[model samples]
Target: MERMRIAVAGASGLIGSALVRSLTSDGHEVRRLVRHEPRSADEVRWDPEKGRLDPAGLAGCEVVVNLAGAGVGDRRWTDEYKRRIHDSRVHGTAALATALASLDPAPRVFVNGSAMGLYGETGDRIVDEDSPAGTGFLPELCVEWEAAAAPARDAGVRTVLTRTGLVVARGGGAWGKLFPLFSAGLGGRMGDGRQYWSYIALHDEVAAIRHLIDRDDLSGPFNLTAPEPLTNREITAAMGRVLHRPTLFPVPAPVLRTVLGEMAGDVLGSARVVPRRLLESGFVFAFPGIEDAIRAA
Candidate 1:
């Protein structure tokens, strides 16, 4: 890819921050869309919640990536927090898409963030990018989230929706919370442990995003997950093997329900999602299996 101007929303986040670093390291001119007042030449100001964004801020950028959203696992699923999760992604994405559409020579690509939760509980059924969305709160949220990018797509800009899975990483994310507990021998399966968990290493997640940005023919939703999906029990075993700890503890479904409330269903639910489109696009995974992803983290 040639050196180009790129703008990224949510540039301070786990994947976003890493992407900015990767693009900058390659000598791309990276502009960060910040909510606060611009503090430097590289920072542009925008407030997605309030539907605030200046089209000029993203002018001349060949590509724009939107990853801003409230963390789903950040807090217990209170009604208010759930609203934040939905609005943050839907509204923020709409704002960015509209701004991109307004550009005179709109960006060549718009890569927006989504999640695998769109499939809901697959109960061991293999799902891919073309699978119909399952019924549930998470699934409905994802539908709206991806639809929010219509402005950019409708304006003739190539738009790519990345339905990312659980990112295996040492940094912040659901997987980040697992290392300490598993290393301390306190980690265990969330429920029956039969539920499938589709995951990709943080390295592959970032690389896949870059791959989408570089491909002119790729658009629509692509599952950003590894080719293989493993069950929670298998993942727990991998964690124990990787950390050289005993996997003796097991948390029951009732216990998880009491602790995590509504979010517990997501923890225990199964979705055997795969990256059919990503692989077809020729994006390779650095950590393609459970054990490999665990070791990478």
Candidate 2:
């Protein structure tokens, strides 16, 4: 593999941190964009909210990946939190794209973070990169989020929008919450459990990102989900089978709405998303099955 200089925004995030480790361990020069003072030579200080990033910090970097964004599941979806979610992704993307555009010899690739929530509530209707954006806050947010990367694309950089799905991991994200609950025998499916969940194991998720970075011929939106998406009930059974727990309890949709407010829709929503472009690009997933993903998680 050819080692390259890469700069990453949101270097502290769950996916970002993992991606940095993968890159650096492979002998690639990885520069981290941090909000605080640079703690080391590898760290660069930048304020995405203020639209400030020094091009000098990213000079000569062959690839720039912007995974910076507010965690969608970090808190309840209040109006304030919704705005934070929207602004963080848009501003961070805009900052990175604009900075890359201004570079005399800009980076060759720009991988901006996006989510499968772009196609909200698919309800078992399988969708791909060509699918139209669904109607809702999430869809709208994703539209704007992807649009913010226009500067890099217009500058002739190979731009990729990774429409990531639920990442099954041990320490953070949705799976993080699920692990503890299932371990304690308190885990169960939500609603009628018919909701389709398109997920990717964290391992595969990182691998997909690296694949995108390496593929010079590939650009545009790629759904970073496993090929076999399962329904919520099917996932519950798999979790039970993997973790050796009982999948008896089920959280009703009304109770979820009462507790999660606007966020309930996301949990109850069904998005049978497929990674058509990613697969076509020859990226392979290590954990394509929910059972294997749960085990990995």
Candidate 3:
């Protein structure tokens, strides 16, 4: 594959940082979109809230990836925080998409970040890229979030919405919180533990993003999850096994609700998502199972 100039928003995030490292290591030029003044030649200043970005800074980029969004599970979901989550994704995506569209020579591809929460609670039913959007705050938010990228698609860019799942990594994300608890033997199943979790290793997550960047024939939503979806109970057992810890306790759904408020619904909800599109596209996973993913983390 030939190296190309790529610009990434949210370059400081877990997946974003990993992507930048991967791209640069492969000899591709990477420009980071930052909110502050450019700290280096590779960084470009862009204020997403104000919908501002210098077109000249993005001129030579062949691909633009947008992963800019507020952390969903960072805090209690207050009305204020909910709005922050919504605006951060919708407005930020719109800002980037519009800017990409306005470029004299727009990027060939635009990979937008989305989440599996778009499917809401699927219980035991399997969902794929073609699945209809489910009900709930997250589903509604993701609907608008993906829709916000229409500008890039309308501009003839091969836009793709990556509906990522639980990314297992020791550094950050949900696994960052879980690894400590499991290591200390405090980890347990959330709620009844029947809820399914679609997970992927951080390495595989970055690999999938890179795969998307290279595949010119792919477009629209692609589920970035492991093929074998595991239940919360199975995941707890796997973590305990990997860490040589005990997984005997169970956090009741009520307590989760009391502690996490609205966010608890997502924790307890079941989403049996699969990477049907990715599999069909010939993209393979390095850590496709809970045990392997936990061990990798």
Candidate 4:
């Protein structure tokens, strides 16, 4: 638990930035790995597509948190953008894994990013780390992304793939996207709103990453989500209550299907993921449920 050297890729991202802040607060020496020249004092550079990186930046580090990848929801899944999504994850992961493997003094631990989408549409089933992977575009992407990190594991580094869920924060992440319409009484169920929506708060997501770092016994995929999962309607209702608003305007299923196309699977499909491994590992959630999380955040 002494001061540890940590290098975080995609340090500017929602999760990565939080990890940097948390590690620094915990008295860890944290360094940021950026895609471009960081116009500041605290950054190292890397270009994944070009297969370039300064592995020296990762040297002497005890932990390497890989949070790099294109924003999954940042763009509509056009044919080209879909390719970008897949490439951003697989290529970036490959570059980092390869870089880490070739380093003389490589990291002892690698916390790579994955997603609950790896389980695909599970309907009402509760999935855990040991559950078999599902079949879908998202699942395929997650599989490849994690596979790209195999070299690091082979190099004797402790590796964990965080199969994360919807991360909700008041001013950021998925909650920020839905708050406006719901708070304005213009938001309602999407499709039937019966589809499950597994989620975690920004606070717990950050804390869980740190917990993973501290728990040396953990490896492989761990579901980074709250123990209590909810349906879309359930989440919407909780948000509306927190904001003192009414969610009366339903987004028709046809509209979503039309706009999202194959991507609509993300919104329509169900994923009731559970943090079973983390829970069994004696990890406790700061926000175990939607109501408590919304109020605290």
Clashing pairs in 4: none
User: lDDT by residue for model 4 over 146-216, one digit each (tens)?
Assistant: 99999999998889999889888756566667777776788788899999999998889999998899888
Per-model CA lDDT versus the true structure: 0.91, 0.92, 0.92, 0.85
The C-alpha TM-scores of every prediction are 0.98, 0.98, 0.98, 0.96
Off by over 4 Å in 4: none
TM-score quality measure for candidate 4: 0.96
Model 3, 124-218: lDDT tens digits are 99999999999989999999999999999998999999999999998888899999999999999999999999998999999999899899999
After the best TM-score superposition of candidate 1, give how far the Cα of residue 288 lies from its true spot, in angstroms.
Answer: 0.7
Report the lDDT of model 1 for residue 212.
Answer: 92
Give the local distance difference test score of model 3: 0.92
Candidate 2: give the clashing pairs: none
- Tens digit per residue, CA lDDT, model 1, 148-174: 999999999999999989889878888
Clashes of each: 0, 0, 0, 0
- lDDT value for model 1: 0.91
Report the C-alpha displacement of residue 287, candidate 1, in angstroms.
1.3
RMSD of 4: 1.4
Q: Quote model 2's TM-score.
A: 0.98
